[model samples]
Each structure stands twice: as structure tokens, then as C-alpha cells.
Target chain A: MTTVFKKTPVLTDTVMHYCPGCGHGIVHRLVAEVIEELGIQDRTIGFVPVGCAVFGYKYFAVDCVEAAHGRAPAAATGCKRVNPNNVVFTYQGDGDLASIGAAEIVHAAHRGEKITTIFINNAIYGMTGGQMAPTTLVGQKTTTSPYGRDPEHCGKPLRVAEMIATIEGAAYVERVSVDSVPNIIKAKAAIKKAFQCQLDGKGFALVEVLSSCPTNWGKSPAEAMDWIKSDMIPYYPLGVKKDRTNE
Target chain B: MVSKVTIDENRCKGCGLCVRACPKKIMQLSKTKLNEKGYHPAEVIDQGACIACASCARTCPDAVITVEKE
Candidate 1:
């Protein structure tokens, strides 16, 4: 058979530990393809956060550094500064980014750190057994919120992309999903642009991907993807939120 | 017109995302067979109708699906 779609070399042959249907695998491939397409694999430095993707170092065939929960931005900033020629990026989950690492990511963007951040927002925290994350939707029941997420008690879900776009140092911010082929294609383009923005030294670029958590959300892989389409997109909304690179 | 879709059984996690992704609703998970991964991988039920849309390959998290258009 004639070859059409094959795995990218940037991804290691190691089998991924991600739960089947989780969005991490798709996002990882997109990031790997972006790096190889840009020819920066030789000098790319990845910072994997403490989440389901904590072991991301083993999956990507590139230099990787493990960072504490919510500390990837800090590590990525230092990496980019010390090795200015190298491309530095971070892979973080909603719990790791919007909650614990919120301060670090905000400061990194504030400082105009020349690095890219691949933020995966599945709403509920994974790996830690489906705890409610900062991005969890209202009334969405999680392990931590058995009765559903109450807005009066928990306040509203944080819109990280919209909030980050206001920061003066942010170069690019876009939210995409992987529920369908068209959306997945858009996600690849957004991811590529985020990396390019960093390569061009624009500033701190972030691609907030609204991902699916089938195992955690107590839904089939297909239902989880549908959840993203019906619920997540309404609140998160897709497309670029900011682009200071044009300036 | 001939087209084909193949799955790398070892890498397949039996996620079933590809089954939902198929526009023609032709993909299904094996009920009686398991791959080396201990999971039943997806297979095409109506190979002749496959348009080589590659939607299954794109939605597959493991990148195990390969599509060829002829």
C-alpha cells in the first residue's frame, strides 16, 4: 500500500502510557511534528510537568527536563535564557497550569519569556484521580466536587487564554480542540504557530488545547470528545485570543 | 477505485475514537480478538466503501492507523 499517514520520527517508539482516547497523545504528536518540521529537534528543550504527561520526556525524542507541578514555566524560562539558541517549551495540564503553576506562567508571560507553552485543559485533573481543576466547568462533578462544581462556592472556571491575552508580553494565545478532523487540523496549525512565535523571539506563546479526559470524566472516548464539543467549546471558545507578534 | 486502512495492532490501544471518527461508520473493535497490547484493536467492516478520508488516522491518539488512497 502507498504510504499516506505515518508516525513522526520526533515521537519515540516507546508506547505511550496515556489512557486510550486521552488528548495527550494527539497533542504530543503535533508538538513533535512541529519541532521536526522546524528542524529544531537538535536544539529543542522540553519541560514536562507533573501531570499525566509527567513522563513526556520518555516519549519525545528530544532533550527533556522534568519540572515540579506548576513549575514548568520557571524551568522553561531558565532553559531559554541560558541556551538562547535552543528552542524551549513546556507541556502542562490544567491542574498544573491554571492552579498551582498559574503564578509561574503569568510571570513568564509578564517577563516576555521567549518560550512556547503547550497547555492541555481537560477541565478535570487527571493522574490524581479526577479532581476538579481550575478550568472545570460549572456544575461539573469531579472527585473533589461530588455534588458538582458550585459557582457560588468555587467561583467561575478560569478562562486562561482570555486572561493571558491581556498580559503585555504575550505574543500569541489560541485555544483549539481535537474532537474532529477539522478541529485537529486547526490545532496543528495553532501549535505550529505557537512554536514559530517563540522561535521568532516574539514573547511567551501559549496554545491552550481543550482536550478530552474520557477515563476521568466517566465517559467513553467518543463521549468525551463529544463533551468537548457540546460543553467545553461554549465556555472556552476557539481561535486566537491575542497576537502581539505583529507589533 | 481501491483504498485501504491498516492498524498497527501492537500500538493500538483499542480507544474506539477512530470508530466514531469514520464518516461511513465502517470501523469496529474486534470482540473476540486481542492484540499484543491485550486490547481489541479496531477493524474496517466495510473496506470497499472506505474513501481513504484518513479521519480515522487523524483521530487515533496512538497514530496506529494508516490510510492509502488508490
Candidate 2:
């Protein structure tokens, strides 16, 4: 029998703080696995934003900084600018990037900052009691929107990957998910490519991972996966949004 | 050539999607009670007839299903 796979070395032995069935832990492991595979854990630095994954410092065995709410890109910008040789990346949620830190993300992408950004869009705000976020699906109920999101009043979910890819400075952009094992593997590869783009001085790179908030979605872990396949994928649409690698 | 499907009860949420997604009709969710997470997980009744089609594993959200050759 052939060995399927093994855990990544860059990940610490500490158990993740995320809730059971949360997708953050899966994405975290993928990032760590990529870092270990590329042999860059020693020089890697991660910036954690204010969200469910704010405790990223505890999981990754490397230098990590807790950025101000939604200001991770700004902090990562400074870190990569000052220490150009170090591997710098920002882990941000939809609430952080699409809401509070929108300006920071746009500016960073516009300036072509040499950094990688991992964007987790689970639709609802997992932290702070499952409120409707900027990326929340229309007709999706949250603490703020009980009758499901309304386009006439609250506006539609922002497609961050497509929006960010339009920027001239962004060298690579992709949207993936952890709904299945095959997709999870593909997502890891996309994330690794984003990091490699930054390493090559290719400019701003972003990987938007469509995650699941099972607790907030009022569904079991299994239902959340089905929801992702039926609802999230249709709106977000997986694939490479932009790639300037050939350029 | 009977393959048995085993589920890690601790991780299952008893969502019943796998039971709904199964094509072989070999699995049914346990209606007897709940697990540690208070969710009713699916249990295999006729394990001897499983063909290892992987439908349950594919539909499972928690990655808790394990298939073994008996």
C-alpha cells in the first residue's frame, strides 16, 4: 500500500483553536505544508488578521504578527518593504479585507507589493457571532440580516478575487475551496503558487479560499460542504482569476 | 470481496447527507441517539455488501469515513 500523505513540518504540534469542522485549520495546514516543502519556514513571517484565525501565530511555527483589525495587508506591506528578503504573507478573512481593511488591500495591490495574501471567504462573519459580512451571500440570514440578505437594501456579495485581479499590479490571483479532498489539494497548489509569485518578485499575489462557517450557516459540517458546492461555488466560481506568470 | 465502511463517531455530525448521497443504499443514519457532538451519525447496517464505491466518503463533510476490505 502507498502512503497517502503526511502532516507538514512547519505546523506546530499545538491543536488549532478553530472550531471542529472549521475550514481555517485545513487551509492553515496547506500553507504550512507548502512552506515546509519550499524549505522557507526559517525565513517566513505570517501576519494574522482579526477574525476566526486571529490566533494563527499559535499554529504556524514561525514569526507571526497580529495585525490590527483588517489592517494585515498594511502591516505586511511594511514588513516586506523593510525586510525585502524575508517571506511575508498575510492571512485575512472576508470581513477584514472586504470591510474594514478594503483600502489597505486595494492600495497594497495597486502598489504591487511583493507579498502573498491568503483570503478566506466563508460568507458570514464567524467571529463576533455570525453577522452578515460584505461577502455574505444574498438571501443568507445572519445576526444582522434575519430575513436573508437583501440586494435592494444591503447590496450583493463582493467578488474579491475578480475585483482584485483587475488591478494592474497584481501578478496572480486564484479562488479555491476545501469542499472536497481533490479541491483541497488544488487549493494548496494555488496557495503555493501565490507564495512563489511573491518570491520571484512577481508582485502582489492573492489566493481567495472559499471556506465554510458551519456553526454560523446553521448546518452540520456535511451540510456546509453541500452548501459550498451548491451556493458558494456558483457565486464565487473557482479557478485562476488572473495570472501574469507568462508575462 | 466485501468492503466494510467504518465511521469515526467522534467526528461525525450525523448530517445525513451521506445517507442521502449514497447510491448503493447500504448505509443509514442511526436514529437511536447522538454522538459527543450531539449529532446523529450514519451507521452501516449491511457492511457485507459494500462494493467500496466511495460514495459515502465523497459525500461526507467531516472526512470521517474509512473503508476496509473484509
Candidate 3:
């Protein structure tokens, strides 16, 4: 039989552990495809966090290490330092990266660590039963913020990409989403470039993926996609934050 | 045309919407089982009857479904 689409080599044969309509599977596939295309699967070392994407290590076909909540960046830093010849990347969620690990991520970028960081911001905490995260939108209703996120009491969402772009140590930063085919393509390109930045010996590189949590948002898969386009995109605009070599 | 339905067990909030969305009467919620993320997911029965319409997957809020043809 002719094959229209087959599983990518970088993905494991085991079934995925993501939720239905969760964007982690799509993002994981994109990253895997890029790793295969770049032929860096064998040399890539991945650090996974403790949020919804904690099982990322099991999905990818590269060497992976699991870190404590919001500690992937620190772990990736140590990994890169020890294995200078290999490529290192960290796959983190908003709750893990933007909240608990915010300090670690900021320092990693401030120091210009030669590594790639994939930040998946779905607006809420998924693994911990849909709590309000640092990236949750204003007026967004989460389990912790049942009355909607009040800016006065809860503060505002952290725009990590824009903030990191201002740091001279960071050579590349971008925020993209997979709400549509076009957006998914753009996200893949940004992710590939983030890795390429590391390969080129550039400074800190990060890709913030504006993803969806349909279950938490109480919207269907299609509606969640629409929300990312209509609501999330405006708050986290899709584009490259910075590029040192203009590549 | 065969329809596809996938379940992301970990991401499932145990909402049972997939069971309600399946019009072909081929899905059900798991009660005796729980995934790594601590949620019971709807399982597919009689996979051969799927119409590839993706209704269950589309209606899912968690994006847990991955439907494909046989």
C-alpha cells in the first residue's frame, strides 16, 4: 500500500501520552522531524521539565534527562558544558519555565548559554490539574482563578520572548503557534532556526510556542485553535524577537 | 472513507466527552484504568466502523484524539 504519511523516525513507536487536542504531540513531531533532518538525533541531548511536557524525554529518539520542576535550563546548561560536541535543548512548559524556573531561564539567557530552549505556553498549568500559570491571560478563568485572572491581584502574564530579546546575551528568540497549517509551518521554521542558532555557536536561543489547552480552556479542539489565533496571538505576537546573524 | 480517533491518555481530564461525541457507538470511557497524568480516557471499540469524520477528535477539548485510516 502507498503511504501518505508515516511516523517520523525521531518519534518512538510507543503511543503518545499527551491529551486529546493538546499541541504537545504536534510540537514534538515537529521537533523530531527537524532533528532527523539535521541528522543530530544521535548527538542531541534533551532536558525535559516536570509540567505537561515532562514525558517529552520518552517521545524523542535522542538522549534525554528529566529535571525537577522548572530546572531543565539548568540541567541543559550542565549537559552542554560536559558534552561540548553535542547539541543540547530543553523542552519546558509555561508553568515550569515562566513561573518556577523563571530565574533559571533568565540567568541561562543572560549568560548566553549555547543551547536551545523550547517553551510551550498553553496559558495554564496542565499537569497539575489546570491551575493558573504565569502566562495565563488576563480575565482568563482557570481552576485557581475561578473568577477570571485579575490583573490587580494575580499580576500579568510574562512575555518571556520579548523580555529575553532585550538581553544582549540572547542571539535568537521567537514566539510561534500551531493553531493553523500556516502557523504550524512557521513554528517549525522558528524551532529549526533556534537549534541552528546553537549549532552556529551563537548565544542563547529560545522558541516560545503559543500552544493550546482545550481541556482546560473548556473549548473544543477547533475552538482552542481559534482561541490561539484570536486571543493568544494578540497577547503573544508571532514573530522572531531577535537574530544576531540576520539568518 | 475511514475516520480516525486518537486518545491522549495523559492529557485526558476524564471528561467523557469523546464517549458522548462518537455517533457510531464505538467509544466508551475507561473506569478501571488511569493514565500517567491520572485521568481515565475514552477507548475505541470496533475500530473498523470508524467513518473518518473526526467528530470525536474535533469535539475533544484536550486534543487527545489522533484519527487515521486503517
Candidate 4:
């Protein structure tokens, strides 16, 4: 029998610590698959952020570095600069990327660091007991925003993909989700492209994945997927926000 | 052509994504059995009905499903 689907070897045998149905597991698999398919596992380096995926290094078989909160991009930049021949990427969540690491990510992209970033924007902070993150939707209730996020007080959700796309050094930027089968395929393709951008010596590349935090959202895993389609998509439209590889 | 679906019971976290992704509705979580993790692992209700589209394997967050076709 021909195998239609199998787990990628780039992922270690370690069972992920992510919650059941958490988007982090799906994204983690896609990143591992990409690395395996590209045959870059031997020379790939991943920078894991301080969030729910803090144990990312344990899951991915490639060399990894744990960065300070919201400092994945900065650490990734240094890694890429030091090991110009190796593939470098960062796995970060909204709390780490859009909030604490905002300046770090922006500056990394602005400088056109040769690295890829897999940004998981689940709209709320998952690791910290579902606190409101910078990307939290207005009127969305979280532990910190009990009555729903108030735009007057929180301003609004930060569109990291669009914000990073505007920077000159960002060579490729796309926003995708894992709420459905087709979207999952597209998300994987976008992730591959982002990694490819870095492999080609192109500047910074980031793929913002609109993930789900079922535990924090206080919804069933299925309901969380629907919420991503019904609510999150409206605010953070999916598409390629920027691409300079063709230029 | 016949298709085969395998689920690593212990690895499954009972997310039910495969149950939802299966176009044939053959995938279902075991109601009477729980894995070592205490989660009801997913299983195929009717192996003959599986089309081997790998949709279940694709959507599985835990990567517990493996699809093969002959």
C-alpha cells in the first residue's frame, strides 16, 4: 500500500504539550514537514518563544534556541547572522510576537534579517491563562478583558501581517489560518514559501497564522474553529500581505 | 482500490478533528475506550468506506492518523 500521509521525521517523538485541538500542534507539524521536505533539517535552527509553545524545541528535532519573551526575532537575527549558511526561523505566538516582541520583530524585518518567522496569532494569550493580548479583538472577552475588550481602552487588534508588510525589509508576508482543511493546506504552503524566501537569501519573511485557543476562548474545539471563520477572518483577512521574491 | 487508516491510540488527544474532516463520516472517537492519556482515541467505524483522502490525517493536530491506499 502506498502511504498517503505520515508524520514527518523532522518532528521528534515527543508528544506536544499543546492542548487538545490546539492550533499550535497543527502549525508545528507543518513547520516540521516543511523542513523535512526542503531537506534542510540538518542545517535548520529554530528560535522558540516564551509562550504556550515554549517547549517547541522538544518537539522539533532541529537545533533550537529559547529566546526571552518577545525577543525571538532578535535572537533569530543573531543566529542567522552568525550562521549565514543555516536556515533560521522563529516560532512565536501573538503574546510574544505582537505584544512583547513588537519592536524586536519590526526592527528585524526592517533590517531584512534572513530568517523565517511562523507567527501564531490566536487573538488571545494562551499560556498566561487566556489574558488579553495585543492582537485580541475588540469586544472579545478574556481573563483580563472580562467584559470584552474595549476599543476605547485597548485601541484595537494589532494586524501584525499588514503592519510588518509595510516595512521595506520584509520580503514575504502572508496571513493564513488552520480552521479548515483547505486553509490548513494553504497555511502549509504559505509556511513553505516563507521558508523558501529565507533560503533564497531574501529578506525577512513572516506567516501570521490565525490559530485557535479553545481553552482560553472557553469554547469547544469545533466552536473555536467556527469562531475563527465567522469572527477572526472578518478582522484579519487571509492573503499575501507582501511578497518581494518576484521583484 | 482499498484504503487503510491507522490511528495511534496513545498519541491521539481525542480532538475529534478527524471525525469532522472525514468526508465519509467513518471516523469517530471511541466512546467506551480511553487511551493511556485518558482521552478517547479516534477510530474508523467502517474501514471499507474510507476513501483515503487523508483529510483526517491532514487536519489531525496530534498527527495520529496515517492513511495508506492500495
Candidate 5:
């Protein structure tokens, strides 16, 4: 039998540093696979932030950069501006993207930077020991919001994909998840399209993936996947939030 | 028909997410085996009955399993 499928060559031999049930690994593989399929490994540059995936540069065989906290988008902007032909993207978590680096991403998308971004929205912050992030759902209990995120005190969970879709410079914006096999396929397709938007010189593209944080969510790996279906999907929804490429 | 699922013992993190994802219910964690990472790697129980559905491989967070069909 032929080798129908296996780990993409884009990933290195180093085992990921993510938690046991974390979705980062799955998403990473998808991104690497997409790069491999597109034959852009040599030209791709991934930027990671100062979170659990800070060492993401080591995981992928592509040339990757470890940017400061919440600065991945800004860093990608610089790289794309200098090397317009390079395929640049950022792998950012909710806390890093929706919180600290909000302005960076906003301006980057607003300027229609020709780059792709993979946004992992697992609600709670994973790298910092489960703190309440900007994407944390209301009533979600994080380390920072021990009693449960109180909407009365803090605002509701940010709908990042929707918010970014409103910006004119963003050519493609889609929200997908890895909660199941079918969803996983859809997530990959969305990610591929996001990258294609940039490759075609359309504009900014971002695929917001609703991922799992099992360890931080105080749930089993299986339960975390289920949680994405029950809680996360309802809030984030699933589909193309924006597609300016065809227009 | 012959098919089996091969898992990279060392790369497996024993998360059991694939165990739940497998529709055939053929995957199990090795209680007697531990990888270099100190986690029990996943194992196949009924390799002969494997259909190479790849659900296990798809659900694996680590990309640790490879399903072969013949």
C-alpha cells in the first residue's frame, strides 16, 4: 500500500511543546500541510508570539520568527513590506491577537497587507496558565476571572472574525474549527483559501480557528472537542465572514 | 482485505482523543508501554479489523498515527 497520508515534511522532528490535548498541534499540521500542498515552503515565513507556541519557529521547517507578545501581525507587516514576494503569516492565539496585539492586527488588516494569518481562538489564555483573555466567553471561569467572567464587570467575549471582516482591507475572513473530522476538513479549506487570497495578491486574509484548551478548560481532551461544538461554535459561528477576493 | 493502523509510539501523547474519534473502537492506550515523553503511547487492538478509515489519524492532535490499507 502506498503512503496515503502522513506528517507533512514542513514540520520538524521536534515534538510540539503544546499540552496533551491542545489543538495547536492539529492546526499546526494543517498549516504545514497547506504550505506543502501549495509548494511555498521555501518562501513561507511564519511568525509566532510570546505564548505557549513561542518556540513555534522550531516546529515548522519553514523560516519562522518568534515575535514579541501580540506583535505577530506587525512583524508580518514588516516582513511583507520588505519581501513582497514572500508568503508571510502569523500564528497567534486569542490573548495575543485579541488583547495585546489588537491594534497591530487592526491596522495591518486596515492597510490590506498582503499576508495570511491563522488565529487560534480557544477562549481562555493557554500559555499564561489560563487567564481570562479578550475572547473568553461570558460566565467562563478563568484564572483571572475565578468567579466566572462577569459581563457586568468585563465586556462580552470579542467576536474577532466578525470585527475584522468589517475592515475594508481584509480580503478574506473565515471562522472554522477542529472539533470533528468534517469540521477539520472545513478548517483546512478555509485556511488554504486564506493563504490563496494573499498569494493572489488580493489583500489581507485571516482564518479564525476555534480551537480547544483542554488542560486550561478543566476538561478531558474528548470533552474539550465537545465543548467547542456546544459552547464555542454558538458564539463564534462558522462560515466565511468576509470574502473580498472574488469582488 | 488487510489493513492496520501504525502509531509512532514515541510521538503519541496518550491524549486518547483518537481513541474517542475512532469509529471502529479499535484504539487503546498502552498501560505497559511508555514513550520517552513519559506518556503512554496509543496502540491498536484489532488491527485485522481496521478499515483504514483514518478517523484516528485525523483526530490525532500530534499526527502520530499512519493507517495502511491493502
Candidate 6:
């Protein structure tokens, strides 16, 4: 018999603390698999953000540093600068990346930091009980936006991938989703390419993943997946936003 | 073609994603048994019906399912 599917060894045996059906787990597995496939397990450094995945250090079986809220990019920049040869990446959620650490991320991309960032945009703050985030879609309701998001007051959702792609320093940028098996495969491929971009001494790379928050969104797992397809994908379309690798 | 599927009962969170992804309609969450985490783990009822597509494993967020083909 041949094994068709199994867990990658880059991830620790510790069970993830994410909610059932949370996209973090799927993305986490993809990152781990990429690190393993690249054979960079020993030199990889991951920055864990202060969100639902704050415990990310416990799952990834590699060097991990806990960064202040939304400051994962800043922390990763320091680590990559110091090590130079190490593979550095940051795993951040919507609140941590688009809201609080907005400046840090933009500056990192502006400076063309040699690092990769796995940005999970679930549209709501999962760790803090589903508060409306900067990436929260128009008319989407959250704890803070109890009556549905009012774009007149709250403003439209932020498109981080597109914004980063416009920057001159960013060498690679892509937006992908994990709503289905095919998309998951594509997400992994995008992640692999982002890491390869860094290995080839390219500038900054980021893959914005349109993830789901079933519990926070007040939807069943299946419904959450469907929502990503129906609502999220339209707003945050998946594909390569920018690529300077061949150049 | 024969395929075997094994779900880590202890690791499953009863999310039912595998059940939804299974094209053969053979996967189901346990109605009687519950895991240590108090969730009904997924199980394959008609193993013969499994096509070894591994879609269930791919969609599973918890990575609890393993698929093998003979």
C-alpha cells in the first residue's frame, strides 16, 4: 500500500489551538509542507503574531519568535537582517497585518526586506470575538459593526495584496484562498514560490490568503467555506498580484 | 482499485468538512461515540466506496485523515 496523504514532519505533534474548520490550520499545514519540501527546516524562522495564531510557535517545529501585535513584519525584518542566511517568514491575521501593523508591513515591502509573509485575511478579528477588521467586507456584520458595516463611517475594506503589489520593493505578491482542494493546492504553490523568491535573494514576498472564520462569522464550517467563495473571493480575487522573479 | 482511510479519532474536531468533501457519501461523523475533545469524530462507513480521492484529507483543516491506496 502507498500512502496518499499524511501530515508533514515540519509541524510539531502538538494539536493546533485554532477553532474547528479555521483556515489557520490549513494554511499552517501548507507552510510546514513548503518548509519541508524546500529542505530549509533548519534555517527557517517564523514570526508569530499576537492573534488567534499567537500560539503558532508551538505548532511549527522551527525557530519562532512572538512579535507584538501587528508588528510581525518589523520583528521578521530584524531577524532576517541579523541572520541573513536564515529563511524568515511571518504568519499574521487580518487584525495583525491590515489594521495595527499596517505601517510595519508597508515599510517592510517598501524597503524590500528579504522575507516572506503569510497573511491570513479572514475579514474579522478571530481572537478578539469577531470584531470588524479593516478587511471586513462592506455590509458585513461584526461585533463592532452590529448592524452591518457602514462604509460611510467605517470605510471600505483594505486590499493589502494590491497595495503591496504596487510598491517598488516587493518582488513577489499573490492572493490565494483555501476554500477548496484545488485552491488549497494553489495556495501551497504560491507559498512555495514566495519562499523560493526569498531563497533566490529576491526582495519582499507576500501571499495574502483569503481565509475563513467559521466561529467568528457565525456560520457553520460549510457555510463559511461557501462565504469565502461567494463573498470574499469577489472582493479579494485570487492570483499573482506582482512578480519580479524573472527580472 | 482499493483504498484505505484512517481518521485519528483523538485529533478530529467533528467539523464535518470531510463528510461534505466526500463524493462517495461514505464519510460521516459518529452519532454515538465522542472523542476526548467532546466532538464526534469522522469515520468511513463503506470503505469499499472510497475512491481514494484524498479530497477529504485535503479539505480537513485538522489534518486528521490519512489515505492509502493498494
Every candidate's chain B TM-score: 0.95, 0.88, 0.81, 0.97, 0.94, 0.97
TM-score of each: 0.97, 0.82, 0.79, 0.99, 0.98, 0.99
Candidate 2 runs further than 4 Å off: B1-70
On DockQ, the leading prediction is 4
DockQ for candidate 3, please give it: 0.10
Flag regions of model 6 displaced more than 4 Å. Answer: none
Indicate the worst ten consecutive residues by lDDT in candidate 6 chain B. Answer: B14-23
In model 2, what are the clashing residue pairs, if there are any?
Answer: B14-B40
Q: What is the lDDT of residue A164 in candidate 6?
A: 99
Across B1-70, the per-residue lDDT of candidate 3 in tens digits comes to 5545667666666655456556787888786888876767788877878776555654443445677775
Candidate 3 Cα misplacement greater than 4 A, ranges? A1-4, B1-70
lDDT of each: 0.93, 0.85, 0.83, 0.94, 0.91, 0.95
Model 4 Cα lDDT, one tens digit per residue, A106-137: 99999999999999999999998999999999
Per residue, candidate 4 scores C-alpha lDDT tens digits across B1-70 of 7999999999999988888788999988998999999999999999998889999998888888889999
Q: Which ten residues in a row have the lowest lDDT in candidate 3 chain A?
A: A1-10
Q: Estimate the overall C-alpha local distance difference test score of candidate 1.
A: 0.93
CAPRI-style docking class of model 5 based on DockQ: medium
In model 6, residue pairs whose N, Cα or C atoms come closer than 3 Å (at least 3 residues apart or on different chains), thus clashing, are none
Best-fitting candidate, scored by lDDT = 6
Please give, for residues A163-230, the per-residue lDDT of candidate 5 as tens digits.
99999999999999999988988999999999899999999999999999999999999999999999
Q: Interface Cα RMSD for all candidates? A: 1.2, 5.4, 6.5, 0.6, 1.1, 0.7
What is the C-alpha lDDT profile of model 1 across A1-247, one tens digit per residue?
Answer: 6767778899998999999899999999989989988999999999999999999999999999999989999999988999999999999999999999999999999999999999999999999999999999999999999999999999999999999999999999999999888999999999999999988888999999999999989999999999999999999999999987777
Give the lDDT of residue B6 in candidate 6. Answer: 93
Assess each model's interface with DockQ, reporting 2 decimals per model. 0.74, 0.15, 0.10, 0.88, 0.72, 0.82
CAPRI grade of model 2: incorrect
Candidate 1: segments with Cα more than 4 A from true spot: none
- How would the docking of model 1 be graded? medium
Q: How high is the TM-score of chain A in model 6?
A: 0.99
